[model samples]
Target chain A: MIEVIRSGLFTTIQDLGRFGFRSTGVPVSGPMDQTSAAFANELLQNDPNDPLIEMAYVGATFLFNKSATIAFAGAICEVKLNNEIVRDRSVLKIEAGSVISFGAMKEGNFLYLAILGGFKTDKLLGSACYYEAVNGMARMSKGMRLSFQADHQQREINLNRKVIGLNRNNGIIEVEKGPEFHLLSEEDAQVLTQTQFTISPQSNRMGILLNELVEIESKEIISSPVQAGTVQLTKGGQLIVLMRDAQTVGGYPRVLQLTEKSINQLVQTRFNMDFRFELARESA
Target chain B: MDNPTVRKYGSKAILIEWEAVISPEINDQVVKTAQFLQENHSDGILEVVNSYHSLLCFLKEKADLASYIDICRCLTIPISELNRTRQIWQVPTCYDTSFGSDLVSISNAKQLSIEEIVKLHSTGIFRIYGMGFLPGFLYLGGLNKQIHMPRKQVVKQAVPKGSVAIGGEQTGIYPQSSPGGWNIIGRTPIDLFNAELERPTPFSVGDSIQFVPISIEEYAQIETAAKNGRYQLKSVHND
Candidate 1:
């Protein structure tokens, strides 16, 4: 068991997400940076769908009551296991009663910590992902005890995976034309691919509001199914890129749909960071 | 001769758009397609979300595009043969002053008395057009024109669960407490979306609903029963 001593800005237990519930109007709330979370699980030799401690901006301090093997990944954060600085993206065997702390974030916004057999959190609707609507709690709080499998035999494998850090040079996000992409004028569409937009402060798991505004023709479609990575052009000319916890359906016109890889990259982006969009035609 | 257009929503989802406008025919097609996909292609399909005129099929695996398209084309079920099982749920609402703080305000805006407003709202048999914006939030159509009011300029931080609200040309019951802009006129005791139940949401798209007014004392009785899981929702099969 790991007890949260000091819950940081926003820390929650998440996996891939709750599936088979979108039809019932539930949002698929999961980790923002799935790529980084997956890497942590890979290093620990755990299932890809294992639950993880996803921290944003800051990270929580945990006291491991039971010794376990774990790994860390995503946005460079200063990690310390009982005063000894640890490296990211590598496996480490934590001793019982060891204090693990995370310092200030260095690169991106989201971080992940994966254990050998995954956290044994309560699964709601087939997912251990934390969604406030489903479980009534969105993030981990201090004094919360997270349970994990204590089978020491599971960590006997000789698994030493290479460290995979965030890609710093990739500033371009790829997207496909949305169903209502043709609603925008040619120049408006071109501006999306050409102009650089900064992430606004009013951003959460639902979506990120861009600082740059492109004048779009006012159009409202009948409420339709929308998903994560859907770029909606609001009537006020604001561009919103939906994130992991976005609504399943929306009334605004969906202008573009970001690629899955781009969504992973975009989730790690910090507030006020500038990025460009690259259009890739849907091959169907 | 009315075939829906299929397109890729993202890497792991396919969207079937029936038409731009909302109609009974379009809704029937949307619900039918969703049912067909859920019944036939439960293999790799993760979930199927349907709106007023569209259905999004989220797949669990990244299958080949050509093969998946072919599979989707083969699994088509005719609208005539589709499952038409639907229910008309009778939801009890308490429109008392304590439950509906905005009722008098909405009454004044619509130039009607509180009793008349409740009478008009309770008369309409609203159809569930979609389910979205939040979990189990049924987007129902058929709001009485006399009681139609725009959404509040400033959204409320949180409304209690089962608040029967009216926004623009639509009306719905809040499945769970959340931030909303709709003008709350009443509250219900029934659990529209209870996580403890096997099926969280009680209603689905294509279902019809009617609101029945109740006193605050009765609200307490029903609310207690609902909490205890003994409250039986009054619903009947619709032909």
Candidate 2:
């Protein structure tokens, strides 16, 4: 068992996502950065889709009541285990009564913490992903005890595996033409590809709003299906990118669809960060 | 109807869309195609979401976009044979001022008495066009033109769950408390969505719904019964 000493910012247990419920309008609330989550799980020799703790902006301080093998990824932060500083992207054997605390984040906005054998949580709709609407538990708070598998044998693994290519600061997000991309005039489309847009402070898991607006006369489409990574051009010329917890359907004109890797990259970027959308090659 | 255009929504989903219009005919095609795809395309397809004029098919893995588009184009299920079973749910609604805060304002805007608005809303059998925005939020069509009102200029931050509202040519029940701009006219006592249940919602796309107005006293009684899992929503087969 692990007790939350300090729940910083927003923290929740998430897997790949909840599936088989989009028809009923349930959003697939998963990790904002899937690559980091998978990397943390991979380091701990757990399933890539195993439920792990996801922290946004800040991370939580955990007190382990039992011995466990764990790994951390994403967001360069000062993580201390029992007052000893530790590095991320490497497996750590945690002893009972060990207290792991996270300091101020140095870079990125999201982090992933994975334990061996995964966390033992109730699954709603075949997913351990925490969605408040479905599971009724919001973010983790102080004094909350999280249950996990206790008796898993620790296995010997490579400790110094170098993880690379996760740097998302390039500000180049690749996108494809959405179904309603044709609605944009040639000049508007050119402006969209050429200009830089900053992430708005009003962004959340549901959608990411941009500080810049395009002057395009956008009309509402007949309410149609939308998903994560869909870039909607609203009537007010606001470019909103739907995130993990976005609604299943929307009425805004979906002008661009972000690549899967771009969704992971965009979520790691902080607010006010400028990014440009690049149209991917049609053949690629 | 002409063949619906099938295209890649993104890398992982395929969108089959009809003509850009909202009509019963278009909705029927959307529902039928969704049903056909859900039944036949199970290898890589995860699920299919049906809307008023399109079907978004989510794939388990990123499949060949061209092949999936070809498969969608090859769908030729006859409309008559592809008719899936549908139900007509009689939803218990309370139009009392306490439950519907905007009832008086909507009555004034439509230039109809409260009783007339309730009668007009209850008399029509609405068709479930789609479910979106919120979980189990049934987007219903077929509202009477007499009570058709535009959405509120400013959206309410918290429209109570089960608040039945009208927005332009559509009416729907808020399955959960959410920010909305629709003009609320009534509230339903029974829950349209329960996450604990194996089947979250009983109603589905292509199903029909009829609002049955009840008194405040009956509303309280039904609310209690529903909370205790004793209340069963009255529904019948739609022939």
Residue B152 displacement (Å), model 2: 3.0
For candidate 2, the TM-score is: 0.96
lDDT of 1 by residue, B83-175 (tens): 677899999999997878789899889789999999999988888889988888998888889988999999999988889999988898888
DockQ of 1: 0.83
Q: Which candidate ranks first by lDDT, i.e. highest?
A: 2
How far residue B100's Cα lies from its native spot in candidate 1, in Å, is: 1.2
Error of 1 at B75 (Å): 6.0
Residues A104-157 of candidate 2 have per-residue lDDT tens digits of: 666777888899889989999888887777888778999999998884665675
Q: lDDT, candidate 2, residue A1?
A: 95
Worst 10 residues of 1 chain B by lDDT: B62-71
A153-272 in candidate 1: lDDT tens per residue?
545644465456785526788889888987878888888788988888788888989988886675888999999999999988899999888888899999999888888888787766
Looking at model 1, the pairs that clash are none
Indicate the residue-level lDDT of B166 in model 2: 92
* Deviation in Å, model 2, residue A26 alpha carbon: 0.4
